[model samples]
Target: MIRVLVVDDDYHVAHAHALSVGRMEGFVVVGEAHTAVEAERLVAEASPDLLLLDMYLPDVTGLDLVRRLAAAGRVVPDFLLVTAARDIDSVRAAMQLGAFYYLVKPFSVAALREQLESYRMWAERLQGTPERGRHVDQDVVDSLYSLRGAPVRRTTVVRTLQPTMARVLEIVTAAPEPISAAEVAEVLGASRPTAQRYLATLVKKRLLDLELTYGSTGRPEHRYLPRRS
Candidate 1:
């Protein structure tokens, strides 16, 4: 399971977010922190695989904590910023400071799951596998750096959606029933519209089958299932 730490000054938010992440498959919440100082201590001791951080803390900025970790030669886990603040400047700074993704407040659990899965895939690739491509080169391994070590994007929507889309193709193809966008959103913590957009892309790619389902109230809901060769 992917070990995670949720850090926030607010007690409720910290626990709630941790619980939300724990509900996802192949994930476990290893710790929670209500202050930057405590967070640093816990991260060092627990050695989490992922850290969900809040921007504002009782003591210092989250970015400062990350910087401190790097300076102290501690293990730098992949970071996902979960904050209410949407300041462009702060967002840019955090990304530049090497946050993997920044999740805005009120995001769905699906978004969180998507990001976690992305991290998992990235980690697995780095851990190496026997069946890896024979032609794989340094650049292929380098691209995986963007997954944990480098900060390429700010918004969780973009950071999470791309990997989630790839996984959705897998899920839909394996599911026995047609999956609706709402189901996809539920699994990934994304908006239904966002899920639908990705689903549409897969359909365009001929990787999914799109159909319309009628609700009991006679409403039409679009559904997608995997297309088999």
Candidate 2:
């Protein structure tokens, strides 16, 4: 089974994530922690395979907890960041840490399950490799890198990114905070409509995430964020 440790400052939200993981197939909630101190204790006791980590914690940030663990030469599990923080720096840091996935907050159970399924497949592949010399071949390495839980029907992978698509991705990934199409247009010297088209495409490609902020008067504004690799 894929053991999971759910960590969030909010008790209710942490319990909700743990319950959701418990209901899934072949996954178990080893423990839930509302603070980094509790999380470190549970990591030693439970030894979970994955962490549904929140960026904001009462003691220290989730990212810092991971860093501290590594610095102390402690065992660290695969991380799946589940947080509301959309800053580019956070995303870059998570990627550098080699997180399996980064899930944005206010997400649905179905969305979470989709990523879990992909993770399960990837983990199974790693666990199932032949033991002769205990080394994976180039094909296995390629498969590991290419598995992003993308749709099974997506086969025509683009080797080179289109100029506009590349620019939109760059702008969002470098942004200090979640930005809107208007901001993107201003940065690219393009029209709002044109910016929206590119942002929508990036979201569809899973290269960026779209968040909605609702207002009392009008429609919810769509904000774009960089998607973690």
Candidate 3:
């Protein structure tokens, strides 16, 4: 099992993250701490395979904690930074200081699972595997670099989709309902015509399933639900 240490100043946040880590099979939560000083002691005592670090701590900044560990000739476990702060400068500094992955707050369980599973696979590859798959090789190398360097700045990747399509996808995925384009537009802050165009795109992408409702109204309205896996 891959041993993990969780460090967060907030007790609830630390416990929640530890619970999430424990839920994944083949992973163990070995320790948790609320302050940078406590985190340093835990890291030394636990010697965890992965450290789920928080950026803010009561005693010191996470970056300074890492620096102090290095200066003290202590062990530095592979790190995954889970932080609420999203400033580019701080993120850049964390990357340079050796964080394997920088996860922003409000991430879903799916996202957390995705990152942890990726790290696990990479760890497996590093343990003297004879031949690594292409995806494994790429993911492992990229993850390492992400830990060591700043992430490239770019506009939101999710916004590349057509506005209506994006809104439709978010809503349907969150709550599946056969919502008309007008309704979707109102909820998503888009024009009715624009919503209609994106709705068609979402249907084309197979992200939404459209159904026509024939009520005694001016026209038959189309509703959409999320396409489940």
lDDT of all the models against the reference?
0.79, 0.84, 0.76
lDDT of 2 at 57: 99
Q: Of the candidates shown, which would achieve the greatest TM-score relative to the real structure?
A: 2
TM-score-best of 2 and 3: 2
lDDT of 2 at 77: 91
Better of 1 and 3 by TM-score: 1
Residue-wise lDDT of candidate 1 within 116-215, one digit each (tens)?
7667667666666336555667786676775663332323223334577887776676778998888988887888888888898778645678889898
lDDT of 3 by residue, 84-197 (tens): 989999899987886778899878876776677667655654674346553456665664444232332122223345555565678766764578878888888878887788
Which candidate leads the pack in lDDT? Answer: 2
Per-residue alpha-carbon lDDT of candidate 2 for residues 1-229, written as tens digits (9 for 90 to 100)? 9999999999999998898899876799999999999999999999999998999999999999999889879999988889999999999999899787788888898778777767776787677678768777899788877665432222222223478878888898899999999999999999999999999987866668899998897799999997755
- The CA lDDT at 38 in model 2 is 96
Q: After superposition, how far is residue 197 of candidate 2 from its true place, in Å?
A: 46
Q: Which stretches of candidate 2 lie over 4 Å from their true place?
A: 148-229
Point out the higher-scoring one by TM-score: 1 or 2: 2
Clashes of each: 5, 0, 0
Give each model a TM-score.
0.61, 0.64, 0.58
